[model samples]
Structures are given as C-alpha cells and as structure tokens.
Target chain A: MLTKRIIPCLDIKNGRTVKGVNFLDLRDAGDPVELAAIYAAEGADELVFLDISATEEKRKTLAELVRKVAEKVDIPFTVGGGIAAVEDVEILLHNGADKVSVNSSAVKRPELIDELSGRFGSQCVVVAVDARQVDGQWRVHLVGGKVPTEIPLYEWVTEAERRGAGEILFTSMDHDGTKNGFANEALAHISGLVNIPVIASGGAGEMQHFADAFLKGKADAALAASVFHFKEMEINPLKAFLRAQDIAVRL
Target chain B: MKNIVIIDYGAGNIQSVKFAVERLGHQAVLTDDAATIKKADKVIFPGVGAAGSAMSKLRATGLDRLIPELEQPVLGICLGMQLMCRHSEEGNTSGLGIFDADVLRFPDSVKVPQIGWNRISGLKSDLFDGIRDGEFMYLVHSYYVPDCPEAVAYTSYGIAYASALKKDNFYGVQFHPEKSSTAGAAVLKNFLETVS
Candidate 1:
C-alpha cells in the first residue's frame, strides 16, 4: 500500500531557514541542512523548501542550500517559490532537488506547466494553487495569497492536470493561519475533478485535521508549517494518531 | 577502491545518485562515455522522466548499444529499469530488451503516478539481504513492470508489480533507493558491496 505522506515545509531566505523553528536541540536553527536532517531522522515523509528570497543571488544561494541538503538528507524534498522558468528548475534539480513546484508563474503563463512536464517529466512538476472562496466560488490567488485572480479553483486544477502537472498542492487562503482545519470541501471537489494526486495545505491546526484532510478531503498528502516548526506537534506522534484512526501511514 | 560509473545520458537525477555513493565512502563518476563505463568495476544507471526522450539520449550517445553488452555489475533505477525491459507504454517506446518483461501504466483505478513509500515483499537476491520483507521503498512512476521471470521483489499498488528484478549481472529497481532513507541506503550499499 502507498502510505500517506506528512511533509514539513521550511521557508528559505538567502540560503537559510526562516520562521521561528523552536527546536531547542539545534545549534543553528537557520541551517536548513541540519534542520532537514533532523526532520528526516524524526520521520518526516518529505520536506518542502520555499525560497522566498528576492536577491540577485537567490538562485545561487538556493541551489547551494539544495546541494547541502541533498548531500546530508536521505529523503525526497521539493523546492519552490520564485520558480518562474525552466532554467530555474533545471539548476535546482541539477543540484539534487527531487521535485519543483510552480504557483503564480503557472497561472501567469499556463504554458510553463506544459514546457516543464515536456522537458522534465510530470513526476517532477508540482502545481501549487492558492485560492479562497469568493461568494460561493473559489478564486485563485498569487504570490502567497496576496494577489487575487478571477480563475475559479476547480476549473484551474482540472486544467493543471491536463497541462501535465503530476500533483496539485491546494492551499485554501481563507483557512490559512487560522489553525482550524483544511478546506476539505474544496479539496474533495478538486480530488474528484483531477486524476492526479492532491496535497492539502494550510489550516492544519491539529492532528485530526490531517485525518479529516485525508478521510474527508481525500488528500493524498498533507503539509503544515508553524505547528511542526514550533513543536506544537511532532511528526511521529501525529503519524501515530493517524494510524490509530485507521489511516495508512508509514510507521 | 572501485571505479563506479553512473550512465549520465541527460535523463535523470544523476547528482543524488552520485552523492548517495559518496555517502557510502565510494566515488562515482557521471559519464556518457562508453570507454569510461566499460572500464568501471561497477555501473549505476539512474534515470527519471519520459522513456522516449531518455531512450533517444541514450541512443544519441550510443549508450543504448553499449549498456546491454557490458559484463560488469549494473543496476538501473526507476525509468532506467523500465527502459532495460523490452518495451514501455509511455511514449510508446521500445526498450533495450534487457529484461523480458514489458512496462505498463497503472490503471485508472489508482492514482496515475503512485507516489510515496510502499513496501517491497517476496524479496530475494543480495540487493535485499539485510532488508526485511514489507520494508518500504520510495517510488514515483505511472508505469510499472509487471511480475515476470526476472522479478526478485514485488510491490502492490493497484496490483502486484515487479519492484526489483535481476538477470545474470544486471539488476534493476523501480524504486529510488537513494531517496528511501536507511532502508534504501542499505540496498545501494548491498549493490556496491555484495551484489556482484
């Protein structure tokens, strides 16, 4: 059986991990490699590094960080944020990043998904959608859910799958940071609309929220940031909780 | 010291494979050169992406002709393993004809690309000596090699398929051992040290 994955997302800025990761055992919290190794050892099914840097050297710095993490960590990880072109994904994959996710750029050009999947195979391309409910309709957002677009969520994910995106990472903007739960209704709708795997993101406040995302939303995987970063929830215990709920998790 | 050569025909994640070898205290050179691959004591063929394009690159470099002829111990990963077979449904590509089996896409009953960790059972061969039955391996592919005569290990997604296969000196795994944590690393080390 293919087990459901638990992913810890790390935000990167200029080759370092941001966010208040309160792992007291870490000598350097900003060191993404060490943090990645820790997460891997602690049984994180995967990791995602969102490079939010806007420097001229952001590419080189992220590439360097990717190389370090790949050398030390033994689990698969994805790199995203500021990924607008094929060349950016090429350098990151060359440095050993397993997968690359495209968000605003895919909405901007749409052809970027086709070119990426054509050049590097769909398995390595992850299409991330940030959206919120707008008057009983889900509207897509860009740049960390700041810029809004007229495109509806269900139709967009259907198109992304057709465009050769192997997976869809759907983050509900309205439920984000509220720590209530995932947007299961919309997630279930997207899952039914696409044949590919769906990753439910945002609104993961409790462990049962993950279960609901899987059982209710029908998500293939679930991703969270602050809860895992702040030690409010640990991956192993979370997996244990999900297992007790009769969910298939990699123990 | 062993000369490890990774066939780099511009197909897949060659760097991670190289680093995985390095973690085992061995050095591997990524080369498309036939001479380098022929001279190596061991060869690791790692690939990801489309079968047609990967086969074309191998054909362009003449690695397609060179690979099946090499007598040294060779291991193929993911799409590399599928290409070692006779044919693949992906891109409607014909393979190198190393394995007698054919590659197939997973049924619509299951997700297209069955991602994440799945267990390998019915294990045999030196590649899984220390690894136990039901030990998980990382796999990410829509197409799979059905259980055949060469199958030494199996995994069940929508159906049981060959997760690993062996014939004479050649070995292939549908999973990415380099990315599969400790269990996967053990498989790689077993390949480099014992599977000869």
Candidate 2:
C-alpha cells in the first residue's frame, strides 16, 4: 500500500527560484535554497529544481544551488533542464541530487538514456516528456515544449522505459497554465501503458485536483508549481484535504 | 558517546547510512573489522546491492559469523537484512541462519523490484515506537521473506510479505531507513535507543 506522493516544483534561473505561466514571463519566487528548505519543512514529499537557463553561467549556479539545498534538506531532490550529457547527470548526482531528470536531451539522444541507466541503474534516471494535444492526439514536445517530436506520447514513453528510464514524468503543455485541473485523459491513457511510476505535472488548481490526479489519472505523484510557490495553497492543508478524501498521502 | 558501527563490506549505500546515524546525534563507524564491530554499542548492517554478492563479501571478511553472536543490538537493512535469513532465492544462495524463513522472489505476474513508500502495518515491536500502526516506509526490494513468526510488520505489494522482523538481538527491515524520511528515521532511532 504505497501512498501517492505530492511534490512542489521550483524553477531555478540565475541561482534563484522562479515560476511562470507555461514556461514564460518568469518571476522571482525566492532564494532557491531557502525555498527548498521551507518546502521540505512543510512536508513536501519531494522537490524538483529545473534549471531554466542552459548557459554555462546558469549551469554552474544551478549546480551550486543544488549542493546548498542538498545540505539543507534530507528528503530526495531532482535536478533537470539543460541536462544534455551523461556527465551532466553524474555531476548533478554527485552534487547531491538524488536523481537527474532529462527532457529535451532524452528525446535528442535516446541512447544517453540507456548509457546512463546502464551506468547508474534505472532508479536514478527520470525521463520527462512534455506532451501537447495536437489534432485531438497527444504528441511529444521537445525544446521545452515548443517543438513537437515525431514520436507519439505513449510510444515515446514506452521507448524511454525500454531505454531503462526508471520513472516517466509527463507534463501536459496545453493544460500547464490553466490551473483548472490535470489532463486526466492524457494521464490515464499513459498510466495504463507504462508499468514504471508515472508522475503527472501541469494544471493543478485546487486540492481536489491532486485527488483526481491520483484516483482518476492514476499518477503515482502530482507536481505543481505556481499553486505552491505563490501561497495559493499550502501543503499541510492540501494533504489534510487529501487525507480526508481517504487518499493515501504521507501526512 | 555511544558508538554505532555499520559494517562496510563493499555493500550498498554505506556512506548514506553512516551519515544518517551520525545526523541522529550518534557516532556511526563504517567498518568491516570484526574487533570493532564486536565492541560497538550498537551495530547497523545496511545494504542495497544483491544478496548473494553481499553475503560473499561478508563471508570474505568473516563478518557472517561475527554478527549473530553479538550481545548488542544489530539492525540489518535491505539486502543485509535479507542475507540474515536461512536462504535467499537471489543467486540461489544460503544465508546466516538467524531467522527461520527463506527469502523469495515475487511471482512473474506481479511487478519485480517493488519500489516506493509502502505502509508497514500489523506492527508489534518496540522498534515502531512513536510510529503509528500503518506508517509508510520507503522500500525498493526485488525479493522478500515470506511471512513468519518473526514478522513484526507486514505490507502488501503483490502479496503480503514480512516488512519487519525481530529475532533475539538481530533485527531486520526490508526497507532502507537512510532513504526513508522521518518515519524511517524514527525506526532507526528507536532501534538505537531501545535495543541495548
């Protein structure tokens, strides 16, 4: 009876926490390290720090930020965004990131997934797929969800799993900034296809949204950004609500 | 200063376990030396790799014999705990005969490497002090020990298996406390405080 997890995502740029609507118009949230410590203290199941900037300047800053946050919190944390090589994954892991998430890079060089999984074991690698509804069909998006890949959403997920990715992080680009609810239809479709843990991201407006994500969407975890960063919702109350709903959450 | 010795026989996640014990306000010494392991106030044997290989490493260092005879409390984690049983199906290897159970692999119909945070219910030991009946603990094991008299906690993945075991001075958990959050840290702390 493993309980479903609830994670708060923090986007990092220039060594600071930033969040935006659909990956644009970014605003400063807080210091990345301090914000991470606060979330961990507030009982966030896990944290994901995505480096929005891929430049050398931002990369070095993000790596140091990860190291600082790793020293502050005992819970597991993951680093993603602009990670293009096996050396990048190793550097992040060595810098105290429990897992390294690959999105665009995973789609570009699919072999990197196998090479990383073969070296570090599947448990440490997470394949992040950004999907959007195109012509009433879900298609995989690359380059931060701006470019569409040739692979279908479900097929790409299966391929990533076959390439030895431990978990699949599927983010719905169309529903990302809406905050109405999760793309349950897309999540349900993918969850049924993959045996590995599927984490649902994008379009979480209310506490009930998390419940729906787990119950109907069958997501192993639900990750949200603005709702948590802007104090629109607090974790303990949301967890309390989920618990009242009889959803298995770590209180 | 209570010295907690973690046997380091080239097993898995040794440093993390040592860091966890040290973070809990105790001295955790990672050692394979029988003399130091025998003299520690409490011992923790944590592993994450394959069972047969871990047992082979322990045998190479002769710690397989030195562990069970210790008068102090010893906590075995993951593969370290599984290797304390009569035999393990992993690599078809025999283990230290401390528990009267055999380690087994789940059926093909069920998922292999049952991972994530699962609730450990039916708890009946002091190791669960300050923890609720169905506390969720993180687990990542491919093989499990079948339910036995020593089972203090049971969790159901595909089938109900022994989540926690207690046999005299030897205690074993199929989960990693170092990896598990607060609930797990409490289990390790309770083991250290109560098992003397």
DockQ agreement of candidate 2 with the native complex: 0.32
lDDT of 2 by residue, A177-229 (tens): 89989999889988788777888999999998999998899888899999999
- lDDT for position A138 in model 2: 88
Native-to-model Cα distance after best TM-score fit, residue B59 in candidate 1, in Å: 1.3
The weakest ten consecutive residues by lDDT in model 1 chain B span B5-14
- Model 2: lDDT of residue A81: 91
Model 2 CA RMSD to the hidden true structure, in angstroms: 3.1
List model 1 lDDT by residue over A158-232, tens digit each. Answer: 999999999999999888778899999999999999989999998889999999999999999999988887789
Best by TM-score: 1
Pick out the ten consecutive residues of candidate 2 chain B with the lowest summed lDDT. B107-116
Strongest candidate by DockQ = 1
- Tens digit per residue, CA lDDT, model 2, B137-165: 77777789999999999998878999889
What are the per-model C-alpha RMSD values against the true structure?
A: 2.7, 3.1
